[model samples]
Target: MTSASVPLSGPRFQTEPAELYRELRRDHGAVVPVSLDGDIPAWLVLGYRELHQVTGDPVLFSRDPDLWNQWPGIPDDWPMLPVIGRKQSSILYTVGERHRVRAAMISDALEAVDPFELRGHAEKFADELIDAVSGKGEADLIGDYAALLPVRVLATLYGFTDEQGPGLVTALNDMLNRTADALAGKQHLAASMGQLLADRKVTPGNDVVSRMLATALALEAEGSGSGFTDEEIVQDLVVMFAAGHQPTADWMGNSLRLMLTDDRFAASLFGGRNSVAEAMNEVLWEATPSQNLVGRWASRDTQLGGRRIRTGDLLILGLQGANSDPQVRTDGSALTGGNSAHFSFGHGAHRCPFPAQEIAEIIARTGIEVVLDRLPDIDLAVPAESLPWRPSPWLRSLTELPVHFAPTPPLEATSA
Candidate 1:
């Protein structure tokens, strides 16, 4: 399968891909052959159970890009190089002992964040963003609100000042989108993180970076050998921004779109018949933020979901497809009732570490709820079909979410 023969990215799958997914499941079971950029063939895992099996057994299906069969032969100018290239030191690219060490460091750093305070902060950001457009009675929610909230909140948590927020957000967007500017965006991100780390070393503060640096120093003092290097710290910061900022932004956009389009959900949520939490779960089950996770390379020859996966074969988990599997639930109602058996946040060691009660869910819910609270009458400016989405295989983000709402007065104070 070559790139010219088939389309594997999210844009091709955006037009009601359920039928395609169902057909793939029927013809190929859970795992199907698909082409990524440059016609790179990979296994697309679409079954919920199969995702668990593969991600759970990381030894068989490794996260290391070095194990990919085409890594060596792939040219430097390959379009997918920015995403598939193994040039960074992210825990997302590691496995086994190395993965454990990095995961521990990240977990420890996140421990300092108070979930309740984080929720308040997220809400505050949401309100300020909304206020920027609320008085106009119309705004592009994606640009004016959804896209700004998460990055701003994350920047603050990472100890980035207001001046650095826009640059960080731009770099994150370019890097995650894998555009022509991806390499430049990566360089910008590295330089910014390097400067931040240097400053923290000299004068540490109570932010995620400072916490991580302190932890790395303590671990080095114990001669653990697992201590984080400067490069590793930078990589981890990139991962955090990539993982926390964009995905959360996508979730906000997807959830808002769902709430506006789905009559059942829109009525219930806006009418106060259903909670934001319930609506969020429903949206997550239906339109997951991360549609396909970062590809996992097969470490050795193995059979998965009745498909032959050779050593070095790339496996891309179809997160949204798996969550929509008929075997999971008949409809979104089950999701609203708290049957969150979706692979949206994934599973196994690579599962998102943000706990359900805290970080991820709280941030997303608060972001949405605050908007609804500020602009109760907000509605789509155009038909749902007119809205555009980001064209990437890994995420379900909107290009822009234009919305209109009743003009309202801004709050007296913007501080959280």
Candidate 2:
């Protein structure tokens, strides 16, 4: 596998991934053997139907990390352990009937979020974020606004205090930043979640975490819930925390980048509210937040996308690759004008639960709308092509989206 594999790391993965994906498709066809950080081998599923088939049949391509064949070679301290999920007991690793119950609990908890209230929270946080920078004519949208908005909103939804938002952000940044302190940051986040779960147990509120606890209890009362430990609940909360923040933040950042850079959305950035949604949808197709998902293990030897995948083989879902699959998207036309056949949110039973998708949409769209509304005349500070992207194979996100807008007073001074 190492002989034919390409290491899935480089500037190409960041700055010009679509071109890289195209190249991989030409050379490796749909199922490309790729190497992770430690030269560990995995198959990247690049075909649209193949990715669909893999995700759809969870039984065949199981989420259980224990099934991975490379476990013996994986170092205990491997950096990829978190991503590949070594011995994960969370919902992401759950399989079969238990996965269904857990997914339902998560969906119900998120679904109970009041749409109007959710929008209100999004607006509140978005306005606050813009206010922090509105007084300056220049701002890095990624760091100052987009990176900060989703987590703040999510923290509120999950019952974290305004005071705790900064801590959560710090923890998440440290964890994903992949620095020497990454493990410490991850441990801190897990501790915080465990504490929150303990607090919710004592006095549950109308928030997502509390709601999850209540739902679990209700399901157990009805004999519909799988018995899971508080530790597992904490892990699931951490999953929700990580999943909800960065991707949605990138969704906002990427959408804003599109609007600022593309002529089709330039006018829309001013006051055209409708094009905000259009640009966001377009980003999901072209620059999806999640580029690849650390993925399923083959339940048995099987052929996929012309490659023979052996039992216990790891398969990464090449989301952007599948979305841009030439077989399905032959026209070469942009999917911007609301063609959502893209695999951005994934597919099948384990796909992002529909309710979670709605929350992300609300946070992302609302965040983008607030930015455009606040900085009505904003423009990119640097050449669009010169902007650098974060170097991570899993996510397609900008390092910084620098922009200049007319300096204005903070929103609070002008609002009630």
Candidate 3:
């Protein structure tokens, strides 16, 4: 009921912030008031159901990135803004009709895509990845498998070769991991992608890049205002790569760990390849990769959960807290089989613009299926307690998961 804003503590705001989230959930569920850095006062929405409503409501929340400057905790000179075109243009930062148009284009393209078409390709990738790590009996899941796999698939989607995937991964990780130096990496990624777009404009191909180029050209030819320029195209590229990789990688690791650690769930998931679907839902619910509170700024003075927030106040949604809420899954009946309605994919218009949500679900389900079917009783090389966890606020991922497997004949492709 306090109308006043409280200052956020320094230790509370982190690159991969999680500790503060735990505290907020334990202390306040409706709307916990906190400060960021030292002076920025903001309200953290802790419940999952409320978080869903916050993300979905555009009238109450504005997507404008400039509002951060008004907030004390975040630096006004944050480099990622201009470099990623968060200021000039980016569908994620835009609101209303503009967001709608850009989203329409992406949704149309995704609709044209047949997720099943990638089945054989995904299975093959799964096989190759698992096989490469098979003999070693101990592989760093994050460094070796999870981190590398999605980027490779993304590169293929962009019509790039397997060899180019690692470079792209490195560039993206360096940018996101180092928030202070994000601008430099953004420029590097942008320049390279601009060249790729220019080449595609000259001679188109069947890939996401070529498709985006064609879309830009057609929009411009129609005098529909300036479409995505080379830099804007690059921004999307940056988002796709950075957004897609770590989250899914984390999901794979977390999901695998859950099945292994929980006997009942393991029985369901490891029993058959198709059985992983249920376990996937449980893992996603329990350890959502997107653990950070999503950012929003108030468009006007409004009361949330009885607390009055003035116009321009920054707000963050406690995603992790919401997922674990008993109210969201009250009966315990849903997750009785370990199922949950976690907002890992986000909600409403600003949800994942790419087909990443669907793609990740498929990859996680299929990837785990492949491993379980092929190597049924393979124990983790390193014990779960010994596995290292990444200290990231936004992602729940293991640094490495080493596992040892006894030799076994490959299962028939039919089972996969």
Which of candidates 2 and 3 reaches a greater lDDT?
2
Candidate 1 C-alpha lDDT tens digits along 1-416? 12122357654566666677777677667777788777778888888889889888888888888888877668878877655667467778878987877787788788778887788788877877877877889988787877777877888888888789888777877786667888898899889988999999999998889988998898899896878799988988887877787778878788888888877677644657356677678768777887877678898898987777899998888998798777775553456668777887778787777542256676788888877877858889999998887766666778898888888877754333
**Which residue pairs clash in candidate 3?**
7-35, 8-35, 8-36, 16-392, 16-393, 17-393, 48-322, 335-338, 335-339, 381-403
Off by over 4 Å in 3: 1-26, 69-88, 179-188, 268-271, 332-340, 374-376, 407-416
Worst 10 residues of 2 by lDDT: 219-228
Each candidate's lDDT (Cα)? 0.78, 0.88, 0.65
Q: Over the full model, what C-alpha lDDT does candidate 3 score relative to the true structure? A: 0.65
Which portions of model 2 show Cα errors greater than 4 Å? 1-3, 222-225
lDDT of 3 by residue, 231-308 (tens): 666767666666776687778878777777766565654464544666667666666776654477788888776577
TM-score winner between 1 and 3, please give it. Answer: 1
Compare the candidates by lDDT and give the number of the best one.
2
Residue 24 lDDT in candidate 1: 68
Pick out the ten consecutive residues of candidate 1 with the lowest summed lDDT.
Answer: 1-10
TM-score of candidate 3 to 2 decimals: 0.84
Give lDDT tens digits, candidate 2, residues 54-105: 9999999999989999999988889787678686788998999999989988
Models sorted by lDDT, best on top: 2, 1, 3
Backbone clashes per model, in order? 1, 0, 10
